[model samples]
Target: MTRIFIQDKATFKTTARTYDDAGFLHVPGRVSKTGTQQYLRRELGLDGDPNARVTVYRPPEEVFAADSLASFDGADVTVMHPGELVNAKNYRKTSVGLIRGPGQQDGDFVKADLVVKDADAIAAIEKRGFVELSAGYTAEYEHSPGTTDDGTEYEYVQRGIRINHAALLPAGAARAGRQARLYDHQPKGSTMSKITLDSGRSVEVQDEATAALVQDHIDRLQKQVTDAQAELDKRQATIDGQAEQITKLQAATADDQITARLKAVTDARARAEKIAPGVTFDSIDPVEIQRQALAKARPSTDWAAKSEAYVQAAFDMAFDQVETTDAHADQKRKLAEDGAKVVTDKAKMPAYDSYTARFTQPQAKE
Candidate 1:
C-alpha cells in the first residue's frame, strides 16, 4: 500500500483560561460543597435562574488532529485563454507572505525543481474564454503530533487533485478560519484512513476527510442558491430600470403644450422592451388584441416593444423562480434520501428523531 506521510505537529488548542480566571486557586474554591448546594437549588428551582451557568465538555481523548484546514484535493489553477497567465507571486515564497496552498512557491507546495502544472493553466485563462483553472490532485501527507508532550512524527505524501483559478483569488490557504461554518462532516474520498497510532493518537483523517466532503457539498448547494438569487436580483433590477423609463416617458408625455406624450410613451415602451422582455401582465384584452392595425396606430410608438418587454421579463422571472424552486425541491429530495439512509443505519438508529424536507407541505387537494 502506498503510504501518505504528513508531519506530526502539535495541536495544543487554545483554552480561554476560564477555570483559572479567578485570582484565588484552591482545591475546592472553584467547585465546593457549598457551591453544589446552591447550584442544586438554582438548577432545581421552580423557575429557572436566568443567570445560572451551564457547561458542556468533551474529554481530551476526543480531541483528534484538528489544527489546520484539511487539504482535500490539492488545488490546481488553470489559465483558460491562450495568453492568460495567473500571477504566481503567492506560489513564490517571496509572494506567499503567510498563506500556503498547493502549487505555492517558496512556501513549498510544488517542488522548486518542477514547474508544476498550475503555471501552465494560468497561461491558458489569460487569453480567451474560461480555461480549466485547476483539477483535483493527490495530497502531500504529513504526520500527526503525539497526543501528549512527547513528540510523534509522520512524513507527507501525494494524493491527486488540483484547483486552478489562482488569479481570481490572490491568496490561498482559505480565508475562512473564523468564517468557517460549523458542521459535522461525513468522511469519504479521503487520502488517509481511520488508522490508530501509538501514544493514544488516532491516525484517522477526520478533520480533513470530513471537512472535504462537507465543504464540497456545502459549496455546491450554496453556489446554487447564490446563483439563483443573483439571477433573480439581476432580473428585478432590469425591471426596475424599465419601470423608471416608463415613469420618465409618462412625465415627458404628460406635457400637452409639447405633444411629447406620444414620443415619451413610444420611447419608454422601447426601453422597457430592451430592459425586461420577460414580464407578462393580463394587459392583453381580447378586444384590444383584435385591433392589430389599430394597435399599430396607437399613439405610443414603443408600446409593443415596452409591453412585450415587460411581459417577457415578468414571465422569465417567474420561470426562473420556478426553476429555483424545483432545484431546492430536488435538494430537499436528496436530503430526504440521506435522511433515510441515516434512519436505516443501525449505528444511528437510536438518534433518528426526525427527518424532514424543505418542501414537505402536502397539497391541499391531496
Candidate 2:
C-alpha cells in the first residue's frame, strides 16, 4: 500500500458544518502542494487514463454491505495522543458519507459528513480541539526528471496512481502534516525534508526541525550498535583467558608426570644397588624395567616354563658358590658329594644310555 499525505491548514475546522441537512466534519481531502502533487501523480493517479478514476472509500471493517458499489455504515474513528498513533485509544464509530467535491481533480477537496450516531463522540472530538485524516492506497508510477526552485535536479512521478481507501483520523497531526512538510513545493526556511527516489538518489528537502529529528534517530541507532560490539569483545576476551588457563594447566600436568617418572627411576636404582653389592646397574632405565616386568608377567608359550626353571637352577648354583667361604667348608664339601652321587645315579638310569661322562678328575693346586 502507498501512503499519501494531504494537509489542509485552511480546513482544520472542528465545528460541525451543515451540508444537505447532515452534520459534516469537512476536511481538505487534497492540496496542491509539491508533496500532494507527487502523491497524486505517484500514489493516486490524477495523470492516468481518462476513463479510470480514483475513489476515496471507507475501510473493509466499516463496510456493512457490499454492492457493485460498496456501502459503508460509518468510518473508523479514534482519538490519538499528539505526535504518535501508538497511544491512540478511546474509540467510537460514527457513520460518515464521503463527498467528492466538484472538478474531481488533483487539487480538489473531498469532504466527510459525520452521521452523528454518538453524541459522546462529537463531544470528545470538540474536546480534543485538533484532528487529521489518513488515506491508504495502492498504485504504480514512473519517475521523471524535475528541478526545484533553486534548479536542483530531482525525480517526480510521471503517471498512473490509484487510491484504495481514506479514513478520517483524529490526532494524526504528527504523521500527516509533518510528512506533508517534507514534500512541500516551497518549504519555509525552517522546514526539513528528505526524499529518496527509485534511482538510488537521495535529496534532503528538510527544515531545521526535521533535520534534528533525523539526526536524533541516527544517533540512537549508532549507540545501540556500539554497545553490542563492546559486549561481543568482552565475551571474546573471557574465552581467550579461559583458553590460556587450560594451556598452562596442561603444561603443569606434563611436568608433574616427568618428575614422577624420574623419581621412580632413582628409587629403583637405589634398591638394586642395596640388593646387589659391588654390582653397578648403570644401564637400568625405570621405564625399560617396568616394560620387561610386564612382558615377563604376560602369558607365553609352553617353552617359557622350562626356560624359567633352567634360569632358576643356574641362579641357585651361582648363589651357593658365591656364598660359600672357609666358615662353611664342611657344608660345601657335603653338598658337593651329594650332587656327585645324584649325577652318577642319574647316568645309570634308562634315559642315560646315550650320555657319556667327559669330566676329568680334580687336580690338586699346591
Candidate 3:
C-alpha cells in the first residue's frame, strides 16, 4: 500500500445562505461523494511510476469510514487549495473558514456543515458564485484493477481515506486542476501573491488581504526584535568604554607608584652620601645605609638589635651634630686669619677693653 494525496470535487446548488448571530455564514453541503472515479497522478517517490495517470476508485466503505469522515470535522476550509498540505505550520495563513461538523453518510455522499468566517471568502462565494468544494485528503492506494458495479473501470482503489482540508474551488475549477498537487510544483506567482516590506523583503501568500494581515504581524514582531538587539548593542558599547577607562586609570596609578618609589630611593642615597661624604652608597638598601651612618657617628655602639625607626633617628641626630661642629670650626678659622689688630683711639680702645674684660679675671698687680 502506498500513501497518495488526493483531491476530489463536488458542486452544491444552494441559494439558502444563512448566518448565525455572530455574523458567520453557514453552508450545508456534501464535501465528498462515494462511488466516484477520480483521475489521479502519482507524485514522485510513491510506489507506482512517477507522474503516471490512473483512475482511482472511492468506495463508500472507505469514503464513509467512521474515522475518515470524522477527519473532516474542524478541518480548515481554504478559499482554494494553497497547493500544499494544510497543517499547523501554514494553517493560520491559508485557512479562511472551518468545516464544523463531523461528516456523516447522507445516502451516497458525506454531508457536513462549513462556516465562512473571512469576509473576503464570503464575498467571493456569495457574489462570484464560487460554491464548489474540493476535498484534499490522503489515502492508501491498493493496486486492484477491477470494474465497478456501474461498469466504471479503475486501476487503483483508495483505502484508509483521511480528510485534511476542504478547499472552496473557484467557479469552473475541476478536480484534475494543477492546484491539486503541492505548491512547490506550481508555477511562480500563479496561485499566490507576494507582499513586499519596507526592507525590501517579500513574502508569498495565497491571497492579498490575508497576506497583508500576515505581513503586518511579521513587521511588528520584526521591529520588536530589531529594537531589542539595538538596545543591547548600545549598552555593550557603554560597558566597553567604561572598562577601557578603568584600564587606563590603573596603568597610570602603577606609573605614579614607580615614580614615587624611584624619587624616595634617590633621596635616600643623597642623605646617605651626606652622612659619610666619600662613601659609595649606590644600589645599597636604605636600612643598611642608615646603619652605616649610625656606626660612623658612634664607633663603639652595636646597632644590630635596633629597629629601622630607631636607627634612622640616631643617624639623623649624628648628622645634625656633625653639621653644627663643622660650622663652629669654620668660624674659628676665620677669626684666626684676622688676628691682633690693636685700637689706638681712646673711645674705641675703652669699648674694646670693656668687651675683653668680660672674658678675663682680675690679675694681681705685679
Best of the two (1, 2) by lDDT: 2
Comparing candidate 2 with candidate 3, which one achieves the higher TM-score? 3
Cα RMSD of predicted structure 3: 23.2
TM-score of each: 0.20, 0.26, 0.45
Give stretches of model 3 more than 4 Å off: 43-52, 174-366
Evaluate all candidate structures by whole-model CA lDDT and list the values in order. 0.31, 0.39, 0.71
Worst 10 residues of 2 by lDDT: 64-73
Question: How accurate locally is residue 331 in candidate 1, as Cα lDDT from 0 to 100?
Answer: 100
Off by over 4 Å in 2: 1-16, 19-95, 100-124, 149-158, 171-366
Badly placed stretches (over 4 Å) of model 1 are: 1-207, 255-366
Error of 3 at 290 (Å): 99
36-80 per-residue lDDT for model 3 (tens digits)? 354635541355565666777778889888999889889888888
| Error in Å for residue 159 of model 3 | 0.6
